[model samples]
Target chain A: MTSSWLNGRPCDGLPVHDRGLAYGDGLFETIRVAGGQARLLDRHLQRLSNGCRRLAIPMDTDDLRNELTRFFQVLGQGVAKLIITRGTGQRGYALPEPCQPQRLLLGSPLPAYPPQNALSGIRLFPCETRLAEQPRLAGIKHLNRLEQVLARAEWRDPVYAEGLMRDMSGRVVEGVFSNLFMVVDGELRTASLVRCGVAGVMRGEIMVRASQHGLAVVEGDISYVELLQADEVFLCNSLYGIWPVTGLAERVWPVGPLTRKLQAVVADLLSDS
Target chain B: MTSSWLNGRPCDGLPVHDRGLAYGDGLFETIRVAGGQARLLDRHLQRLSNGCRRLAIPMDTDDLRNELTRFFQVLGQGVAKLIITRGTGQRGYALPEPCQPQRLLLGSPLPAYPPQNALSGIRLFPCETRLAEQPRLAGIKHLNRLEQVLARAEWRDPVYAEGLMRDMSGRVVEGVFSNLFMVVDGELRTASLVRCGVAGVMRGEIMVRASQHGLAVVEGDISYVELLQADEVFLCNSLYGIWPVTGLAERVWPVGPLTRKLQAVVADLLSDS
Candidate 1:
């Protein structure tokens, strides 16, 4: 990381006793910064606040916004990762009295991906690792991400850029670090995140955009067979706006018209932010 | 917290990039150190090794044993916590190439609980938070423990000593930080950790001692109804040894003979260790 900050001060380390390091009791947001501004930061903060509410972690939105502004102002163009954890505590499962949340901000140069990934598309590895269903933790981008770490380790080949993960009941969930959407039977469909999956801000953007474009957006279960039958498949995240899935398993998909249009719209929206 | 060490060095902080703080991609063990010896240290190490194998994190058992011995030798009486993270990384879910696991050891004064907890018994609050079933993540004490934190946060009343957590399927699994056991039909039974629950070291010790005593130990599904019907209910952890459950919801259970006997055996085994 090029630049980092803990709380409001510049630092490269965190207290080992932070609950985030101890029990993954935390939430993180990876934002794309351009021209010294974190793109779609409000959306990210909205999601973060929702997570804090769901997890019962007290958050001061104004203070967080001020810190984010300060952290992003010094960066020209890069990815800014923000982490908020229930602060230091003595050993025990119970929450410590007078808990104070700790925030860590990091800045890193934009990762280099092949040009073809955006123009042509990327391939997917059908990961054997499945996401567990926990409704309480389903839609929030909290720090309990061992499943994603395990899924990302399933393949080392450069041919596959991302891995597709499914829930235990054989329902396609999402990508390792992105949301999955498919154009099936001329309808835009994505798996619901109510059971198990991080509800990405980019996903919310796409659903809204699809609705504006007069496309039927279905947030429900999409079986592996159903996903296979889709005319187009795509993965999306805040950093990587969208990548059409050119290949998955034995099947292949083309960069369909809807995907191309959605990509263009998302790029425009991100640039504006 | 009295003292701390990171990678055998006296330190109170970990790098912000540590995977343990980021994704909770690690395992942890809290051992009770008494009289300059960590009680049930071998059992703790065995469970930690099992966690390492399950999570695919490389561990050198001999080196870890030596480190633990050195760490405990200087401490007379306290709770020692050991955390092994997948170590530092750049940015992404994929494991860093040639990953070196990070070890953090911390010592804290043993918590002071009321004497009545052990002599009379403790009360339980039926937690609203439910544990998700992921066999791959189950039975091992990994760092992804937000579920326990959430369950423990359900009530602020000091009346309930420990909250009882049930699985997503409504099976009485265990407590927030300990294992649960019940005596039914003159048989020693406990919820199976096969689906979702930490296979605690103390729980293992109790199981072995019960079997040696010629008791029928049943590890199977335990519904709420079954839990209520149990002649006796008790909770056990390495630190406190055992605490019989005098009340759960509206039901009450007596401090039965089996609970007393198992507690005595566990205490003896721990003392010997």
Candidate 2:
């Protein structure tokens, strides 16, 4: 079952003139909800706030928090997807004066993935769809996700749980729906999203937790060769917790100690939520 | 008054879960409607068709044509904006099997621009926003247009009619909502859309008309310096026909013979429509 609230009203639709549909002028957050609590909400809100500020979309964070609280009470356990659009506009790219930003909240039942896959590991498909390096639009989970959609469309095999995408410069950046991390030379590293790719909230949380646990986390460019040569690799998002990537193409990776340790950390966090 | 039709039915709203709003998984076209005829419509449909093919969005061109004909009959004289999205999905980037493409057509009064814009010329705002190179998406009139939105937002001054944008590599690309052309020495030149830019339909028409009229038309890389040094420059889109660019920052150019010739050609075409 799914439920939606548009601007604090129980609604399943928005005006067709909404800029989100017209120009993808918006930011979104897919939050994990458990036991009626939104997990890592502050991080999600922080990212949304940063994106909103960059896009100059007016936001009242306090009001949003209250609305989310109310929505979660009915949501209980599921995923809460929040979309903040610049709202409806006339025919033009210019920002509408007195912009009425639209806030949409959708609650859906958590996806059912094979238990054994998460327990063992998942394979990653090498996607050909490259992420365009746009520094201004990078990092934020904006609505302009056609690249991800194309990358995700590259495969239909259920065995490949995710598709790994590289940037236009052929640097391994991230998975279609998650952030990627690899253990290289006994150091934890993830591609810097300064060029392209969405900065997942879980990825941020893991970086913080890993550093607190005494792991050196580095964020920089990671070439495909570097990723293939890494000791271990994994993918993460807010809802799925963590899934160790055991294979990409023909290259195989063992669920190394770092992957296991971080998985445990995330598992605990999700459980506590 | 604005009128809208969704999938051939009168509707003002769409489901919030529609991928157009969620991920911008769609293509769009803004066509001019005059005397109950859609101007440059074949070219617009051709571009839309190409974009749909690239994005793998199923489209029935014949059906779309019939729908547009019906829409324009009621619209009479206005601007017709058409959007075709990948439709609703189940919270993932993966293409929905048996995807239902949603077609939306909106009619609105033509923008009341200062008549002097076409008669004399207009100034160009040097936008800081740079278009990111993504070959797969380059030339298509896709829904992911936040860059244009941002560029347009750079200035609210009514004096600067349009903003000129460049690629990340500092190559002059196009206007915020139009294609740009420059006359260098004796040849007509427009920035190549192969790297990053929307290939405007009116641009194609102008190129064809210029070539038929014995002018050398070239589409390739154009540096900001090259544009400023050009003998003449102009912007083109389906709606407004052509607007000769008079100035950019401190640089200025006269409305040269080639611009006037092409403008006359477009003016005739629009008038016929």
What would the TM-scores of all predictions be?
0.97, 0.98
* Tens digits of lDDT, candidate 1, A62-150: 99899899888887688999999999876677888788999999899877778688778999999998898899999999999999988
Candidate 1 all-Cα RMSD: 1.6
lDDT of each: 0.89, 0.92
| Model 2: CA > 4 A from native | none
Candidate 2 lDDT by residue in tens digits, B166-189? 999999999999999999888999
Which stretches of model 1 miss by more than 4 angstroms? A269-273, B269-273
- What TM value does model 1 have? 0.97
In model 2, the clashing pairs are none
Worst 10 residues of 2 chain B by lDDT: B264-273
Tens-digit lDDT track for model 1 on B1-273?
Answer: 477898888996899889998899999999988777888778899999999998889999999888888888866677899999999987898888788999999988787878799789999999999999888889988999999989998988999999999998899999999899999878999999998999888898888889999889999999999999899999999988899999998898889999998888877644523
Q: What is the TM-score of chain A alone in each candidate?
A: 0.97, 0.98
A1-273, model 2: which lDDT tens digit per residue? 388999988995899999999999999999888888899999999999999999999999999999999898889989999999999876799999889999999999888877765578999999999999999999998999999989998899898999999998899999999899999877899999998998899999999999999999999999999999999999999888889999998899888888989988878656735
